[model samples]
Target chain A: MTEPTLQSDLNSFDLKAFLTEYGRLVVAAMEKRIARYPEESRVTQAMRHSLFAGGKRLRPILCMTSAEAVGGNKDHVMDVAAALEFIHTYSLIHDDLPALDDDDYRRGTPTCHKAFDEATAILAGDGLLTSAFEILSHAADDGLLPAEKVLTIIAGISHAAGCNGMILGQMLDIEGEHESLTREELEDIHNNKTGAMIEVSVFSGAYLGGGTPEQIAALDVYAKNVGLAFQVIDDILNVIGDPKVMGKAVGTDAELGKSTYPALMGLDGAQDFAERLINKALQAIVSFDNKCDPLRSIATYILTRSR
Target chain B: MTEPTLQSDLNSFDLKAFLTEYGRLVVAAMEKRIARYPEESRVTQAMRHSLFAGGKRLRPILCMTSAEAVGGNKDHVMDVAAALEFIHTYSLIHDDLPALDDDDYRRGTPTCHKAFDEATAILAGDGLLTSAFEILSHAADDGLLPAEKVLTIIAGISHAAGCNGMILGQMLDIEGEHESLTREELEDIHNNKTGAMIEVSVFSGAYLGGGTPEQIAALDVYAKNVGLAFQVIDDILNVIGDPKVMGKAVGTDAELGKSTYPALMGLDGAQDFAERLINKALQAIVSFDNKCDPLRSIATYILTRSR
Candidate 1:
C-alpha cells in the first residue's frame, strides 16, 4: 500500500498522482471545516481520531473525478466531495463500536471507541453525520450549484446513506453473520452496504457537475459496476493481501466469519468476476472524453491495487 | 396530562385541539413516508416502534404552531415539522442505548434497543437521522418553499442538530455526569442537549413561515426564553410531578445523578425562575396580533403543564 503499483492491464493514467492531487484538496476541505469547531470538545477529538485514521480517500476522489469527467469544475463539488468522506468515516466509527463489529483497531490504529470512550464515539458519529448535511446544504450558499441542484444532490446522497441503502446493508451484514450465506445473499448485502454509497458518489458528482441525462445515466451504470468490483477486490484482498502491502491486518474478515467474495467463490473465480465487472464498468463510460481518464484508471486500480 | 388545562393566564386558544390537529399531520407525514420502505427490514420496524411510542409531539407541534403564529399557513412548514420529530426520535433512540443512558423504557414501553436488539436500534437511529435530511431537502420538489430557503432551512437545522448544538450537548451531558455542576454548566448542557433543537424548531418554522425580520427577531427571543423554561419545567416534573400525570417515571434524573435545575436550585427557586422566563417569553410576542395567541398559550402551557 506504500506505493500504488499499476499491476492491472490499464496503466495509461497515473492513478497515484491523480489520487495525491485531488485527495489533498478533499482532505484540506475537511480539515479546514473541522477546524472551525471547538478543539477542547472530546467528541471532536474522537471524530478527528477516526477521520484521520489512514485510509485512502477513494470515494471523494471518485466524486471529484466524476465531476471533472462531465465538464464541471472539481471545486464546485469540493464540499460534497469532503462530505462523502465524512459519511464514510462516520459509518466506520459506528461500525467499530462494541455493540456492532467491536473492532479495537481500524487501519492499524485504535478505533474511535478504543481511542476515546463508547459514548464519545457514538456522539462523534452523530456529529459527523449532521456535519455532512451541513456541508451539503451550504454548498448552495456559495452558488456552487443551483439551490435546486443542491437539494437534489442532498436527496440522492441521503437516500443512499439512509434506510434502504447503507444502513439496511449494515443490518443485513450482521444478520447473515451466524449462517452461511448464498452467493446471492452475500452480493445483496455488499451491493446495499458498500455499493450504494459508492455508486451515488459518482452519480451525485456527475449530476451536480451538470452532465446530460444520457451521460449521467451511463455513469450510473459504470458506477454500479465499479462499486461492486471495488468490494469484490476488497474481499479478495482481505483473504490473500499481504499485511505489509495492505497496511492492515490480513484475513480479519475470515476470522470474523463474514461472507466474502473469495469465501463464496474460489480465489481465481473471484478475481475473474472482479475483472469482468471492471470491463463492464469501463464499457459504460466509453463515450466520455479523455477527461474521464481518471475514471478509467480507477477501474484498473481496483483490480491492480494490492491494498 | 390527559386533558389540557388552562392553569396559567394565557389559555385563550384551544391548545388541545392545536396539538391534536398539528400533531396528527406530523405523524401522518412520518407514517406515509416510512410506509414506503420495506416492511420486513428490522431497522424499519425498529424505527417505527420508537417513533410511534407515544410521547407528546411537542417539538414539531411547536414548529407548526410557530409557523401559524407568524401568519403563514401551517401546511407550508409541515415537512420540516415532521423532520424535527424524526430528529428528536433519533436522538431518543441513541440516547437510550446501553452505552449511553441505558434506559429500558420510554413512554411506558420498551426502548428501541430493548424492543429490538442494540444493532437494529443503532441503525434505526441512523436511518431516521438520514431520513430527516431527506425530508428537509425534498421539500423543494413539492414547491413547499423556494429552493434557496429550503437549503437555508436544512443548513440551520443540521447545524442545530450537529456540533455545537444537540450533539455537543449530549457529549457535555456525559462529561458532566460524575461531577457537581454549576447552574451555568447545567444550563449549558440543557441548552445544547435539549434547547438547541427546540430553539431551532421555533426559528426554522418562523423563517419558513415567511416572517419578516422584525417578526422573526421577536420570535427568536420568545423561542430562547421558552426553550430554557421548557427544560426547567422538565426538571421540576422529574422532581415532584406525578408519574401518573407525566406517564413516565419521576426521579430518573436524580437516579442518573445528572445535572439539573432542581439540583442546582431548590424546587421553589426553579419554579419561580420558570415563571419569570415564561413572562419574558410572553412579553417578547406582545406586539403580534391574536394570531400569536397559540405562542402565548404555549408559554403558559410550559408553566402549568403537570407533565
Candidate 2:
C-alpha cells in the first residue's frame, strides 16, 4: 500500500484539545462498559473510583489515534481502546495496594485500596481486568469487530499485561527497590512493565483499523519509542512535578531507592533521552500522512507534559 | 441425537482410579501450560507454588468429563480445562492474601504470599489470571477450538469469574463478616461466589464439546446443584475433618465468625441439605446415561469425601 502524504501540520496541532475531545469520548465508552452494580457494590465502586479518577486516558486515545492514523475508522477500535484503559486502570489499582507501592493517592483521588480496603481493592482490580477481556471479546458479539480480530486483540492485551509483560515489569520494579539497577536493567523493566502494554495498545488499534503488515510494523516502532519515552517522562515528572498537579507525592521513587531514568541518566540527561525518544517515535510514523498528526502531537506532548 | 446407554456403573466404577488417571493427565497439561520462566523467576515461582500445591483438580476433570459425556473430543477441551485451573489457582492465591483470608497454608503447603513476598503473591495472582485468558484466546491459534467458540467460552468464564460473579461473591463475603447474614443472603453469596465459576466451568466444557442445547441446559442445573453441594460439604468438613487430612486449618471459618451451612442449619441439617443438592444435581443429568456417572459420582463423593 502506498503511504499517504502528511496533511496536518504539527505546529498547528492542539494536543490538549485533541486529548480533551477524544479523552471524553473514551471515558464515556468506559462508563458504559463499566456499569455500576446495584446496591452500591463496593467492588464496582472501587473500580469506578480509579477508572473515573481523571487521568488523561492516554492509552485509549493512543489506540484510537493509531487506528485513525492508518485511515481506519476510530469507532471500530473504541472497544479495544476502552479495554486498554481498563487494563491500565487495573494495574494502577494493584500498584497502589498496601503490599505494593502503598501510595494512598492517585489521579487526585484516594487509591482504590485506600478508598475501600485492600481486599475490595484487589477484587476491584481483578474485576476490571476480567471485565476488560469481556469487553474485548464482546466486540465480536456486538459486531464491532470480527471474532478472529477480537481474539487477536485479546491475546495481545493479555500477553502485554500478563506475567511476561507488565507483571514481569512490576516484579522487577519491586525487586529494584532492594538494590541499584543498571541502565539496561531499568530499561528492561520499563520495556516489559510499561512498554509492552503501550505497544500492544498501539498496534492492536492499527490491526483493528485493518492496517497493512508494513504499517503495523511501523507502528510497532512508533509504539516502543513512545512507550519508553512515556516512562522516562514519568520519571522526570517524579523529580520535578508539583504534588498538587501530579496528584501524588514526588520523589517517592528516590525516597524508596527505586531505580528510575532520572536516577540513572541524571535529570538533564533523562530529559534529553525523552526528547530523542519522541523524535524517534515521530520518525517511525512520518511515512503516514497528516492523519498521523494526533500520534505525532501525542508523542511530542508525552515529552513535554508536566503531569 | 439419541441418548447413549449407560456404559459405566456407579457401584462398580472406581472413582479413585478415575480421578487418579484423568487427574494426572490434567495436572501434566497444567504443568505444560504453566512453564516456569528462566533464571528462577519469582513471579512464575509464586504462580507454580500454588498451582502445584495439589488441589483435587476436580474442575478440570469435570470439564473433560463434560466433554466426554457429550460425545465430543476431550482433547479439544483441554485448553479450556487448563484455563479454568489457572483461574482457580489465581483466586486461591488472592484469597489467601493477608488483606483477605490471611491463611498461611493452602493445600498442605505455604500460601503464595507466605512462600514469596505479598507483592510477589499479588503479581503472581495477577499474572495467572492474565495468563488464563492468554491461554483461552490461544485456543484458536492452536487449532484446538474455533475462534467463535473460544470467544464464547472466554465471555462465559470471564463473566462467571469477574465482578458480577466470583468478585461480587467475595465482596458479599467480606461484608458478611461484619454482620449476621440471613440464610438466603448466605445462599446468594454462595451461588455467585462459589457457584458462578463452577457453573461456567461445566457449561463451558459442554459448549466446547458441542453439547446440544438441551444437554447444555441440563449441565447448568447439574453444575449449580453440585457447586452448592461442594460448598456445603466444605462447611461440614471444616467442622469435622482433621486438619492434617484436610490440608488446611479446620474451624477457621467459625473462628473468623463467618457463616457456613452448618452455622445456619446445624450439622445434620447441613448434611441433609448437601445430600439433597447432590441428589438434585444427579437428577438433572440422570437421563445422560452412565457416561455421566463420573459427574454423579463426583457429586456423591463431594458428600462422602474426608477432605
Candidate 3:
C-alpha cells in the first residue's frame, strides 16, 4: 500500500476538539457513577487519586468516537465508554505497583502505590477492576441497550482484559525483562498487552452503537493496526521525545533494557513502519464516509503524538 | 425471636456427605474452566496452586444447595458456583501478598507469592479476577438462562464483590490491624468482607435456579446470618482449635492485635453469639421442605466444627 500524506487532514480535523467533546462527557459520567461507591473511605480516595491524575482519556474517547462512526448517538454508550477508561485506569494502577513495574510517578504525579500505602494501592486497583464489571453489568442494563448487547460487551472487555489478553501479556513482559526478544516476540507481547483492549474498545462502541457486523469487522482491522502503531510511537518517543511534553522521564525504556520496535527496527525503520501501519488502517475504513472522520483523524493522531 | 434446637436436624443430615458431593462438582468445574486459560504458563500455575489448596468449598456448596432448595437443578448453577470460588481464591491470593497479610503459608501450603514470585502471584490474582467475569458473561449466555437473568446475576455478583462489598471490607480489615476495633466496627468489616460474598453466592444460585423473589429473599436472610456465624466460629477456632485440624498456627489474630468477636466479646460470649446466629439462620428458611436439609446441616456444622 502507498503511504498517505496527512498534513492537510491533520490541520483540518481538530483532534483537540474531538477529544474534549467526548472527554467532558466521560469525566462527568465517571464522577456521577463513582459517587455511588465512595462511602467516604480511603479506598475511594485512593481510587480517585489515580483516576483523576490528568489522564488523556484516550480509551474512552476511542469508544465514543467509534460509536459516532456508526451514525449512533455517542452519549448512549457513555457508560460503556466510562467503563473502558475504568478498565484502563485499573490496569495502570496495578501496573505501577511495587511488585509490578514499580513506577514511582505517572502523568507527573505519584503512582497509586507511591501516593497511598502499598496495600491500599493494591485494593484501589482491585476496586477499579471489579468496578468496571459492576458499571457494565449495572449501568448498561438500565434499558439503554438490550441485555444481549450488554453481555456481549461485558464478555468482550473481560476477555480483552483477562488472562487471554492483557494479563498474559503482562506475564510475558515480566518474564522478558533482562532478556532479548525477537521482533515477532515483541509484537506478540504488544498485540496482547495493548492491541486487544484497543480493538475491543472500538468493537464495543460500534456494537453498542448498532453498527453492522461488517462495519465492526472493518473497524477491527483499523483498530488492530492503529493500536500497534501507537505502541511503536510510544517506544520511539520514549527514546527521542522531549521530557516536558511526555510527562515523565525519557529513555526509561532503554534504561530498563526493554525490547521495543525501535530496538529491533531502528528509529527511522520504526517510524516508517508506523506510517505503513497507519496507511493500512486508514485504507480499511475508507468506505465509512465523513461519519468516520474522527476515527480517521485519531489514526493519524496516534501516529503523530509526542507522548 | 426464639432459639430453635438443631440437634435433631444435625443428627439426621450428614454434613460431610453434602460437602463431599458438591465439593466434587466444584472441583471438576474449576478444573475444566481453569484449563481454558492455562497455556502452560507460570501465572496459570500460580493461580492453580492457590486455587487447589483445598479450602472447605463452603461458598460453592452454599450456592449449589441454594439452587437445590429452590427446586432447580443444581448443575445449572455449577459454572457460577465455580466463579464464586475463583473470586474467593483470588481474594485469598491477594490477601496473602507481602504488602497485605504477608503470610507465607495458607491452608498448610505456601501462599501464591511464596510458591511463585511476587509479580507472578499478583498477576495470577489479577488473572483469576478477570477470568471470573469472563466465565460468567461468556459461558452463562449459552441458552441455559435468559439474557436478563444472566445480567442480573452478574450485576449482583459485581455489587457484592466490588467496593460496595468485599474490597471495602478488606480495606477496613487492614486498617483494623494493630488497632483496637469495637464490636460494631468489627462486625461491619466481617459483614462486608465475608457476609456480602456469601449472601450473593446464595442469591446467585437461587436466582439462576429460577427461585421466586420471596424464596431468594428468605435465602438472603439465611445466608447473611449463617455467613456471620461462620466467621464467628472461625474466630473461636483460631483461639482454641487443634493445630492438626486447623492446618496453621492458632492465635495469629491475637498476635496481629487484630480485633475479632472473641477479642471484643469473651470466648464464651462469642460462642453464644455464633449459636444465636446459626439458630436465626435456620429459622429464616424454616418454611422450606426437606430440600433445605443440607442448608440446615451446614449452619449447624458451622457452629459446632472444631476448625
Candidate that would win on DockQ:
1
> What TM-score does candidate 1 get on C-alpha atoms?
0.96
Better of 2 and 3 by DockQ: 3
Cα lDDT tens digits, model 2, A15-86, are 767778999999999988887344388889888888899998988998999999999999888888888999
Native A-B contacts reproduced, model 1: 0.91
- Which parts of model 2 have CA positions greater than 4 angstroms off? A1-9, B1-9, B36-39
DockQ of each: 0.87, 0.74, 0.76
lDDT of 3 by residue, B1-307 (tens): 1122334455777667667777888999999889988558878889899889998898989999999999988878877888899999999999988899888878888889988988898889888989898888865556887878888888888888889899999999998999989888999999999999999999988888888999999999999999899899889888988776766678889888899998888999999999999989999999999998988888887877765
In candidate 3 chain A, what residue range of length 10 has the lowest lDDT sum?
A1-10
**Residue by residue across B89-199, what tens digits does model 1's lDDT show?**
999999999999898878888899999998888889999999999888888777769999988889889988988889999999898886899988888988898888888
Compute the interface RMSD for each candidate structure: 0.7, 1.2, 0.9
Q: Per-residue CA lDDT of candidate 1, range A1-307, in tens?
A: 3455653344566677777787788889899878856779998888888777768888898888888999988888888988899999999999988899888877878889988988898899998999999989889777658998888889888989988799989999998886789999998888899899998899888988889999999999999889889999899888878877665677878777888889888888999999999999999999889899889888878887877
**Pairing residues by index, what is the TM-score of model 2?**
0.96
> How high is the lDDT of residue B273 in model 1?
95
RMSD to the true structure for each prediction, in A, is 1.8, 4.9, 3.4
Query: Candidate 3's error at A132, in angstroms?
Result: 0.3
Q: Candidates' TM-scores?
A: 0.96, 0.96, 0.96
Judge candidate 2 against the unseen true structure and give its global Cα lDDT, from 0 to 1. Answer: 0.87
Per-residue lDDT tens digits for candidate 2, residues B129-166, read 99999888888887768898999999899998988899
